[model samples]
Target: MTMYWRAISEDQPGPKWAGLFAEYWPAYLKWWLKEGDEVRASYRESQRMLKRHMPEMLPLYDQLCELAGGGDQAARFLSFYCPPPYLSGCSQALWPGKAPVLVRNYDYNPAAFDSLILRTGWMGRKVMGTSDGLWGLVDGMNDAGLAISLTFGGRRVVGEGFGVPLILRYVLQTCTTTEEAGQVLSRVPTHMSYNVTVVDRNRKYLTAMMAPDRATLITHAAVATNHQENVEWISHARFTATVERERYLLHRMSLHRDTEEKFISNFLKPPLYSTAFSYGFGTLYTAIYRPRKKQMEIRWPGTTWPLSLDSFEEGARQVNLPGAA
Candidate 1:
């Protein structure tokens, strides 16, 4: 199946939202129902918390429910309020000094690679990012010069909390700085372990290590990968190289050669960018967020698409990942 990318903008919520979500509704339903009772219970708990704390999101959820046929199944599908599954091999780093930029490689299941879509809409700030099931964002940038991205925090634990995507969405909608985003992240609950890397217009950055059971760990680091101080999920096949990937990024950053072209050249290569197609991570696309410029660039090997707050356009490109069929 060919993946489609569409952009929509609205001043106030309306029926037009349905078409944006309907494209992936079937596949979303199939993935959502495949889970067992335990996962369903977790989703219910997440919904309750979201209702209480993040009431601003309720109306949007209502719109999605009504659009998805207005029932229990539709609500569950729109909620997307379950624990996040483990994904590996994401490397995020901040360019030092003025005019800071954030570059990230989103690696995940090949099946979801084709389902990817980038959403840019008006909220508190002009926001744009890519999502899989269409409920929340995977990575995005807001007009306030804040850029946020996620990676599996390298742990094997699940609890009652919202998925990282929604938390990220909340940050993009509400916060304007790295400190404010960190506070929001600390207060909100998450279903599983994850690391969120946030950079702001002021050149400040933070990597939040978040899980349901513990307090959020805010680290001021230039680079983040699948693991933290040490590799926790070393036994898992996907994270065997977590430490190596982390080291590669840090070593490169340590050289003080902070040129954009150098980093892009390296990130587009092996280890930093995954090509595995068997069962683990595969690099779908590289996203570069320029906080000062208020712009974003989606880069594949040969082609690139640029977007900004003042103007936007919907586009799609067909290309093959390095080692895929």
Candidate 2:
């Protein structure tokens, strides 16, 4: 299958964003209403949650909601409050090299994934990364020298909280350092289990094990794969190879003492590089973030698409991944 990926830059929410929302809203609405709209949060509760937790993003939220056509279902979905449960496979690590670099592979089913990279200057802050839910980020960096990414926590419990992607979006929008990101991650309620890893330009990094039912665990771990401190979901851990991936990353952190280039190359092959699209865990793209320089790049096996906070260009590519079809 060939996925048509796009990179778009919008200094503020406007026509470009509206067009995207228009194009994506139908499918999103179907997914949001999949379990029935009655099961999702009401528009009132969704708005209230947004105002209470991420007040700073309310303005941008309103803009995106309006662009999504001012419908109740659209508004609620954009809020990302108590939405349906979702999961993905991913691996993230902070390089122990001289310069601070955060790299990860976003493992997900391409059919359900948003093949869009968005660069935005909303609320006077420059932020960009792989966009999900139209307004949320799967992984992204800011001009503040903070970068972040996520992986599934390999658990099945779901609770009442914002989706993890929106939490990631909020961190990039409001926080400037690893400390601030940690605070947000620790506080925000998530409906499912997620392992969020963040790194700053100072080379300081931390991973937050966040779930809806328990207090978030803040750790100094440099590597994060699909499970948390323990393998709570044994079958998931085995299928995704979460333990093996974590060990591989940890092993590289100690033994692969070489150029950052070589370190990144490891992610392009197994067992880190996954081709399990048939199982909804294929490695869609690998992201490399240099918070110190405010730059990011997306990598496939033999392709590279680079962008920066300072200068971003709009373009598209056709990506063919095995088993995605």
Candidate 3:
């Protein structure tokens, strides 16, 4: 399947963001309400949760709701509070070189993705990343020279908390350093298990294993795959090869003296790269972020599309991938 990907710049949440919401809402609504209306949180509860946990994002949440026409379902969905269960495969690690760069491969079904790069200046803070659920980010970097990425922790337990993408959005919106990012990640609860990694301009980083049933585990490990401290779900671990991917990354970062180019190239191939689209683990894209330079790039095997806060041109590209449809 060929995906039409676009790079969009909306300094604020207005017409452009609204248009994209309208285009994607129908499909999102279906997914959000997949279990049923009663299973999801109410608009009131979602808003209250957002205000309590991420008060800084309340104003932006209100603005996005207004842009979404202020419907109950849309507002609740925007809040990203305990909604539903979802999962994906991903791997993230920091480059060993002096210059700090965080690289990751987002493995998931392409049909479920927004497939766009969003550059937004919400609340006067410049932020951009691969957008999910319109405003949430699967991975993104802010003007503060901090970048973050997420991988689904292999588990079946679900509890009360926000979906992780919004947590990432909040981190990029409010935090400037890895320390602050770690704090936010540790405090905020997630509905499911997720290993969230953050890297700042100084390259100071941490991986927070966040979940709803327990306290967040903040580890100094620079590399994270699908599972957390342990593979709680044996079947999921085997299916996604979370252990193998983690070993590959650890060995590569320590054993091989790969240059930056070679290190990133490794993620596009086997072990780290995935093609299990039928099982929702296909490698959608490899994202590389240089927080110090304020630059980001979306890379395929042979093609590279570069973007930045300084020169973020608005355009679209067609990418052909396997099993996306």
Candidate 1 backbone collisions, by pair: none
Model 1 lDDT on a 0 to 1 scale:
0.72
Residues forming the 10-long window of minimal summed lDDT in candidate 3: 316-325
lDDT of 3 by residue, 1-325 (tens): 7878999999989999999999999999999999999999988888888989999999899999999999999999999999789889899999999988999999988888999899999988999999999899999999999999999999899999999999999999999999999999989989999999999999899999998899999999999999999888998899999999999999999999999999999999999988787776599999999999999999887779999986799889898775455
Distance (Å) between predicted and true CA of 294, model 3? 0.3
lDDT of 1 by residue, 1-325 (tens): 2234445554344555566667667766666667654456443654687787677787767766777677676676566566336455677777654668888887776665433445455354577776645657878888888999888788888876777887888888888999999998888888888889999988889999988788889998878777765566777524446677777887787766768867866678778788776655577778888888878877767767787755766655665667765
**Local accuracy by lDDT, each model:** 0.72, 0.92, 0.92
Error of 3 at 114 (Å): 0.4
198-256 per-residue lDDT for model 2 (tens digits):
99889888999999999999999999999998999899899999999999999988976
TM-score of each: 0.91, 0.98, 0.98
Worst ten in a row by lDDT for model 1: 1-10
Error of 3 at 276 (Å): 1.2
Count the clashes in each prediction. 0, 0, 0
> How much is the lDDT of residue 91 in candidate 2?
93
Runs off by more than 4 Å, candidate 3: 323-325
